[model samples]
Target: MTTMTDTSPREFKMPDVGEGLTEAEILKWYVQPGDTVTDGQVVCEVETAKAAVELPIPYDGVVRALHFPEGTTVDVGTSIIAVDVASGAAPAPASEAASASASAEKAAPATPAAPAAKPAPAAKKIEGRKPVLVGYGVAESSTKRRPRKGVPATAAPAEDTLYAAAAIQAVQGELNGHGHAPGGQRPLAKPPVRKLAKDLGVDLATITPSGPDGVITREDVHAAVAPPKAPEPVVEAPSAPAAPAVAPAPVASYDGARETRIPVKGVRKATAAAMVGSAFTAPHVTEFVTVDVTRTMKLVEELKQDRELAGLRVNPLLLIAKALLVAIKRHPDINASWDEAAQEIVVKHYVNLGIAAATPRGLIVPNIKDAHAKTLPQLAESLGELVSTAKEGRTSPAAMQGGTVTITNVGVFGIDTGTPILNPGESAILAVGSIKLQPWVHKGKVKARQVTTLALSFDHRLVDGELGSKVLADVAAILEQPKRLITWA
Candidate 1:
């Protein structure tokens, strides 16, 4: 929390809306400069990698300035809005606010060592106050300044003393995940930074923090892993003429009027990274089976008319999902994940059934918790809610986490079949192709039947050919003979 004077504007920083998220792009601002905002009122909506979230103002005040315009990505803990906290006071004009901010930035020291000194005095004023909110606090005590380490209380330079005071206040906030740790404490870093450090096999404690308040940032972790470069040697140019430099290949150019480029970020960017990682990390083996689903189609129609399934979305996908769940119950090992760090296959007792939905933002897979335990109607309701939420772009990050198995209905897009890549951390993904009328062998004769192809992609490391084949066969059998859903399930 930042300490505020009667006239000083209270700056609200961009918080980690989604846990571990490092930054977010400002989608829209609900309040503009000079606008009066009440406490807990949403000021802006931001799009994180996970989802879009609205940030609320912690204190009521007139908006003094918006630090960044829409579409700009701001780092977490960086101030994005400044509010005038004095009662009934109007905010400064946008130009004045911008000019004041620029002037403050220009007045800071050029050196990195005393950068914190500029904001130290204000922060120092609230050092002993107890926190009242996650990132906000109330001033309750006026405590004397503590001496800096290795510097006597009366001997340290004024600038050094101010820096130490600011650092102490920032470290206190770090306990709530905003700043750095004090001496002998765990290194302060965001969750994403910690994960990156682990991936690179770098110890956070060994790296020097460059972020405000001693926090270990992503750059710090990356620097620790980066090998130091040897100084380049200077070779005197030879007497002979230097060889003609090869011309770089002509840069590819496209007609500006005919071509369009879309920068991928937010959900699309995260999805692309996850797909690439899952494809390469998991050795995927997709098994395809074309089965007659005429009976399953009839069952769907019948269920739609049943009062118990009334107002429910009774479709082939619903039955397909149920069939997969039943197969998992019979062959419990199919619903399992490969734990590479543990070097083992961890089987799950409960299934979080993920349904892939393509929304305007991008493709998102939100799952239904304990889907295996839900009744047919309950499962349908959950699927309906999931689809609606995705369409509205309100799916929370938690809704997309902890998925065991996923089902992608490519059939709706009129695709015959597709070998879908498994969702990261999931062992299997079942793709449902377009169901259509086709000639099939039925009861001693060839007949026209509703047929569709099902593709099950599994991690080859845990699910062998035999296990994958069995799961696919069971699903096909249930679809072909819908009665088996009741008998086998």
Candidate 2:
């Protein structure tokens, strides 16, 4: 338990984890009320619009309370938790939560008994928090305070300011989330609650808070805004003839158990939006080419044994990526983004090669930065790391941002070629189908050779049929000859 004389709690406000992300939905809470928390400990995981991130508490203390529950979409800089840091209170156990709240309530004074006890309540009001950064301080807001009700109908700004300053001595106590309290105490509500009150023009100070302790809740705000509707006045009509009720139409039915409704959000949401835009805005033209890659498969096995590439991931994908890079080098026009506003085709000098990765979350295309400059071994290392990070769901937003081209290996799913949509802002995407042994003529003799279908989709607005065919043909030719990579690259 905290020192009996010092019952004040410190607040931990949500920090901006991403670039100007206004809000995030709290996915889970690691600590509950009265649970001891140390500085830099992960207290909660939040899923922002960009990605999921774990938030760490900045100071050691007993967790007095969690302000917002899990799944709550909290605004940046709002207090999400409160900690009691009185001396010897570092390790408060969960069982002590009720007793802790009772003590906090007892410590709270009904009114400003001393003439000196007054000032707007804030997280920064605690003296121990001076050593901490201001980012976690009470987030300042632009909303103007609704005038105090008891004040005279005239604006006596100077006199009111002077009188309040002379009486101010910042009240020290844990915040009661339930908003029902005396006029001296300001109503506590989450950002969304505050917004609701503002939109409905409901005065939070006037509503009796029904939330825990004394904080105002969404339901309380809503109740204040909209009360139960009064029943319609009963009008008894004398001797009215009743018409026969029409038979209800048979209700349509289906097996609810057989269907699943997964909410579209996060990576899936972004991919859907991009795909729709790319498909409709840019007319896609896909060309398919089946090639004999018997030599390429043999070369992949040989390179795996080479000392230079021993530790690297060598596969058909690795060689395919290299082949595409060589093809792009030969035809730089294909590696470009169309700038509609500028009314120009912006050709890129460098390639950020994107490899489509399928994670449990959704399909994500994280690109290998400056892929064109990397040697075969270096490219393999990057590709391996990208795949691993994506699988672990630890890929950062930056890794997926910029891209000039992409490759989707449908072969892993044992599927043949697909007309892959161009990743938005890029002109082309290469789809590699499953490679299988097939009958082919080698040196005027029929024999079984490794074969696969390759599909290259390009924005017809930028790439004509002739340019598209050459890029596809070049990639196929290099895969078939394997030795051509040395001469061409």
Candidate 3:
């Protein structure tokens, strides 16, 4: 017997599944470290920018390890999961000349200088073939549907019986099953006429069908359901004596002493304390600016039509993120925070842009770390992942912390504008309002333009009036003329 050499194990990194999503939160795991997994088998659930998506295993092997915890946030290109291929399964070997010859013959031709590679030996052939990580692999058959629960087996009905039943049932059931009485009986009416009968509570069994095919039409149902007209009062009433008046009965009263009290837990409790601390510790100053965003709306429409962004969820919030990044670059001071305990003003070079998302739980500010370093496509992907994680209530503590500046899209709720509160430690928060069509003077002519309001709230001690105004103006300018974003970049 000839000996065989094992192929070297390969590490698989988490690929950038979307345009520029740098990281993803691990929602769940499908396979453990010791279990064998097939290529394309759903291995984990990850929350991305757009939605909570299930990621398929890219390799066929035994899972070697899981690098991160279930709720941990890991950067893209990080080795989150590892797989171990069994030894003695190298693609090519020296022995089994016949199999090697067949593989060589089947292999495609190469350049004149480079010879074609040999195939695996016959001894390496197994009962079942496993798929490779990359390129063309064995195609698995589609999954077949499993039998539904609680359904009983029965013999097939005859063809004539089926047809006769359908035809008779159509008439008896009044065209739709909803119009049928408790017992299966034909109301003397068609579907629409039966609807009128039911609305008027007319007993169809008491009425007669007057239309063709012995069907009761709308007029028949109306006539049957209509109430009889009242007769004129008789003059004999004037001869009768007047009746005596009666006193009204006393009304009962209820005690208003009882009260309802609900305990504050989870999101409510967390939000309350955060708001209180933020309000008291940080001196708040808010500034407002109204902008015409006709260009931004047009760009959003174009992005939605691009085939490259087929599966990605592109929205106005993405443009807002890009504008924020550009503004941060110009006015980095707005992206700093006040560290009270340290007795220092911590000015950061990088921007961890927080997005104040209103989730089912409560208000959460899950941020995109080092947002200024990301490209436009990446920012869009990151925004999608951040929103998705927030909605799912899976945002980690690390992601919720270390935010410098934030952008809250209040426009999504159809609100025009609001003075947004600062997130606990962050120095500034920007509120983007709803985009609406309003009459405006454009180029010496009256026209309908898309308008939105921007509200900036910052800590007075850190962000002064001039700095705050400049930052807010920068963001508004980008939105007003989207082409400015490219030049600013």
Candidate 4:
């Protein structure tokens, strides 16, 4: 019989869960050191640029250590947790068996080789490794909540150091008459509220408390700073000569001689490379057009009440995507990309429409595959899913690649219009601006209409100016009359 060696002590590294997202903050730990975790179980909650994501443990093992503390930030591909796999674990529970079978069915040819057979001694140990419960793993045992800072049940010098820092800041602020007076002192408010007061340029000592314990509530701060109403017009005498304006004190500079550094690990690093690649490689030309999209806005309001579109987010973006798809069909060349190394142009037969998402981490364009094939309702669903996934930082690598054309919704951030840089490998990107009420001359009469600006940036090498203009005009026409999309499509 073949002998098998124990495959214990597997380190679970943080995976690149989304499109080039580099770092994530641990929101909560689902498993602690010494806890047993089963394969495919949620081991922790982590916050990325997109959203809070639950990370699943990939091995059935005892958690050897938590490499990083909860609330600590860690880079992608770093080992966050380590586990000691049980030796001879029995086949996983029935549920896991069923899942494994399903996965096997879906897997393509050439799956990895199965684990080796083991001797009786190793088999017994492996059997011990079998999880006691079913599903991912037993839920972590609950314990009394521990304070985020200060003394812990376990004595540690680091905790004392943090406490000292807090104390020092408090003592210094007191000396400067900036913080609350000492002890019996006054209300019991947290440090954050005090910081908020400082930022708002409010004198916390002057504000009266309204809370049960005389604590100053956030509302109290707002009321104190509320702007005064317009005053009655008053005749005023000429003011005295203004004092010589001393140039505003130069803002305090950082200690440049004693250099401080921020490691480029996450979004900053990813954005730099993507922007550089796109700027230099793509031969870009931008064109702008203004359109009256009053009809499109009306249609959006109508769709918001429709039962079919209920629960799914219905926004101007959905219509914008639809118009772009229709326009691409009419002028297919605008959706084509230049392949410089191949000395050719790739005109994609199907549209994998990329929606440029501005995430906290950076700009990521995760595409909806075969978006051209999806119906309006289906497209809406896909768009919602794409954005939700992008925000949560779970957009897969596959979703970030092979985009044919992109749309940057700058309007969401209140931008009027911009010449968006093309997403690398994509031929065109359309910028959608904020819709505002503007006066327009229509049919010899000036009227208030909902207006928006559309900016289209295309690779000049692949898309001629004429084709680019046609695409923009087609999209504008559809928005001007929503019904035009149905006829054009």
Using lDDT, give the best candidate's number.
Answer: 1
Clashes of each: 1, 9, 4, 7
TM-score for model 2? 0.61
Which has the higher lDDT value, candidate number 1 or candidate number 4? 1
Off by over 4 Å in 3: 1-259
TM-score-superior candidate, 1 or 3: 1
Better of 1 and 2 by lDDT: 1
| Candidate 1 residue 466 C-alpha distance from true site, Å | 1.0
Q: Write the per-residue lDDT of candidate 2 for residues 241-310, one digit (tens) a residue.
A: 3332333566655443666677665556667888999999999999999999999999999999989887
lDDT of 1 by residue, 120-141 (tens): 4434434533342223344332
Q: Which candidate wins on TM-score?
A: 1
Where is model 2 more than 4 Å wrong at Cα?
A: 1-23, 33-38, 59-67, 72-256
Q: After superposition, how far is residue 279 of candidate 1 from its true place, in Å?
A: 1.0
TM-score of candidate 1 relative to the true fold: 0.65
lDDT of 4: 0.67
Reference-based lDDT, each prediction: 0.73, 0.70, 0.64, 0.67
Tens-digit lDDT track for model 4 on 21-100? 68877756767789877554457756554334456554467888889997688988788888876754422323333344
> Model 4: which ten-residue window has the lowest total lDDT?
134-143
Compare candidates 3 and 4 on lDDT and give the better one.
Answer: 4
Candidate order by TM-score, highest to lowest?
Answer: 1, 2, 4, 3
In the predicted model 2, the residue pairs found to clash are: 176-214, 176-215, 177-214, 177-215, 178-212, 178-214, 178-215, 179-214, 179-215
* Order of models, best lDDT first: 1, 2, 4, 3
